[model samples]
Target: MEKKVFLLPFASVILLLHYWVTCLTLAVSLTNLSDEYALLALKAHITYDSQGILATNWSSTTSYCNWFGVSCNAHHGRLTALNLSNMGLEGTIPPQVSNLSFLASLDLSDNYFHASLPNEIGNCRQLRQLYFFNNELTGSIPQSLGNLSKLEESYLDSNHLTGDIPEEMSNLLSLKILSLFVNNLTGSIPSGIFNISSLQSISLSANDLYGNLPMDMCDRIPNLNGLYLSYNQLSGQIPTSLHNCAKLQLISLSYNEFIGSIPKGIGNLSELEVLYLGQKHLTGEIPEALFNISSLRIFDLPSNNLSGTLPSSMCCNLPSLEVISLSWNQLKGKIPSSLSHCQELRTLSLSFNQFTGSIPLGIGNLSKLEELYLGINNLTEYGSEGIVSTSDVYSNGIMLLEVFARKKPTDEMFVGDPTLKSWVESLASTVMEFVDTNLLDKEDEHFAIKENCVLCIMALALECTAESPEDRINMRDVVARLKKIRIKLLM
Candidate 1:
């Protein structure tokens, strides 16, 4: 019985020694693997010109595990993470990066890495966060990437990668953000991408993707918030199932070949801020419900077959609207006067439409209006008569001449002149006096004409008259004198 007890203690000691040796072997292997990857990176032309080689760093001498951008567990010294983002590293990612079998995160984004991603990346089975975006990596996505079961975010955007998306990517069930935009990727979007339940944002814009938008996309990923499928060849009616994306904030499907009226249910997206469905072939009246979206800041649906008068209550409810573009359509009827209430409006384009009648006088009330494009419309003798005065036109002409003289000049100063400057000034002052009392509340108009117009033209006429003592001064000569007068006024 005593001998049996002694054997049990001896066996336990042997097992403990075995475990210690196994751990030592693991630590040495990791150190060797780290050095191998560093060498491979250096040989592959990846460099830090500012700091020279990472292997040459003093910390690497003590142990390869102590290198910069490398972290290991305190007890085991197994590499757990490798981050080289924004390091200005160029050249292909070394396939030996897979040597770090225990790596849980690898970040190499925002670099100048070229060539295709190494297929050996799949060997990092424990990787949870892989950032390979914003690089010059080319070639198709490797199907081996599907082996990374723990990947949470895959950002491969803004590259020259071509060819179809690998179907194997659908296996990454933990993916939350998939951004492949601004690339040369062709072929229709892989249908399997919709199966990722954890996906919250998908940016696939600026690609060569062609085909109708998948109808069940939102149903597959109900948690999606931003869907950017713009600048593609997508056609056919917008899928009604998109309304299922209740949390969607930005939906951009612009520059597609989609036809048919916009889905009325789009108004259901209460959280939506930007809805860009423009440059399509959609026809029908602008949905009234669209204007009711209080959260909408930018609503663009231009270059379509939409017709009918704009709803008077459009901007009445949307107080936060900043940009509304509905130009190049078949819409008719007078523009709603209520649009003047949009105090936040910066750009309003309604050109190339069938609308008729005078523009509302209240349009001038828009204090925040910066650009107003009403050309190619039937707005003849609209409130424009009140908004634009003869003096305003003459002042604008002088300002234009000043700009032109600064840019270029022919031998004749008034090569483009067609009207008499003196006559124009007299007519402008008379018209200004007549409308100044009715239009302006402040006395600035009178002062402006007296100080700017009268002074400018009087000096100009003097210059012209001084050029030639006697002669029936031509309108062209008067214009040249006006230009000189403008220069004198500035001095």
Candidate 2:
């Protein structure tokens, strides 16, 4: 008919080019035998790899592309990566490792892998990183790993996981370090995973997560840097846009039950460094822009309900303060002789507070003060040393020797005695000659008292009856000169 109608359109264009090259050679031989039967179904469920190192080279006479945590791709040999980190590799994980469909990275971290997590690992689809941290895995998580879509770093931390947390991992969107912490996971953190903008670490600490905290924390993950919500049950407040993230650096929300305050612009971040909000129920007054965050280094807040008075210009912007636990709070004033300029302070807890005064003689210049807790406050000594004696129980040394021998401090049953430590060292050379008439008592009786506070209470009873205990005087330097003479008699 016209040469069979031009050879029937050239044999239907060579039969549609041999039917797409026989369907692309049967899809690259079923993707190289589906990566050797998905690494022989993860080495037949590896009952225990106890360093027989993948059971003596995962055999079949080798060449399953040279096995052992296989890593191929030498000019498209496929199976991209499988680290086997900390290789104490135990079992489980095998949903045939989703046939390692061109896996991009799968470091079985700190191995000991147990149950749940292999929802066929979303068939890998070129996964980018799924390190199962610490291991001993349990249920939840694995909503088909949000269909991967090239996932990027999802370390299932500590493991022993429980329910919730998988709001389909907010469809990945190329996630970045979403380490589900300690795990026993419960509800309420799925505010679409903090509106992931390629999250930069969102630990979700020791979970049991409760509500509140998604007021666009940090304008939607502006490259957030570590926000490990500590032992949870998280409550309201605290989300003052978390200081707009500004590349935050660790804000570990400790043992939560959170309540108001603490958000006084959290020092505007400035590349913060560890600001743990301990056992929360937070209240106000600690905001001196948090000591101007000079790249603070560990500023933990203890049992909260914080109060006022600590702002000595934030202790000279602490040159990298190191651990200042605001101990069991209800915190009151004066524990700040500008924290001795935070010379790398190391743990200073202000225990059970109501803090009255003195305890800061430039805290003997800190010298790396190691864990000091001013127990049940209303403090007295610490800074210039001498914590207590004269039978302490706030002994106030027999009421500072009856308020400096104005009478009856000369005990030992004084009848006509010059005893009480020789009548206070015979007035240590006339104790500044009674403050050389430094008067100023504009008061209408009721025991007026104010000749430089009776010459600093007779030079603090001759520096506590001197005669050497290093010449005494350290009831916090006489309560810091009676708090500068009671702030000049309350102005």
TM-scores, all models, native as reference: 0.72, 0.32
Which residue pairs in candidate 1 have backbone atoms (N, alpha carbon, C) closer than 3 angstroms, thus clashing?
A: none
- lDDT tens digits by residue: candidate 1, 68-174: 77787777667788777887777787788777778888787888889988899888899888888888999998888899988888888988899988889989999
Local error of candidate 1 at residue 337 (angstroms): 2.4
- Scored by CA lDDT, what does every candidate get? 0.71, 0.73
Clashes of each: 0, 0
Candidate 2: give the clashing pairs.
none
Error of 1 at 295 (Å): 1.3
Candidate 2: RMSD to truth: 21.4
Name the lDDT value of residue 319 in candidate 1.
Answer: 82
lDDT per residue for candidate 2 within 436-472, as digits (tens), equals 3224323536225444455555556556545445556
All predictions: root-mean-square deviation over Cα?
A: 14.2, 21.4
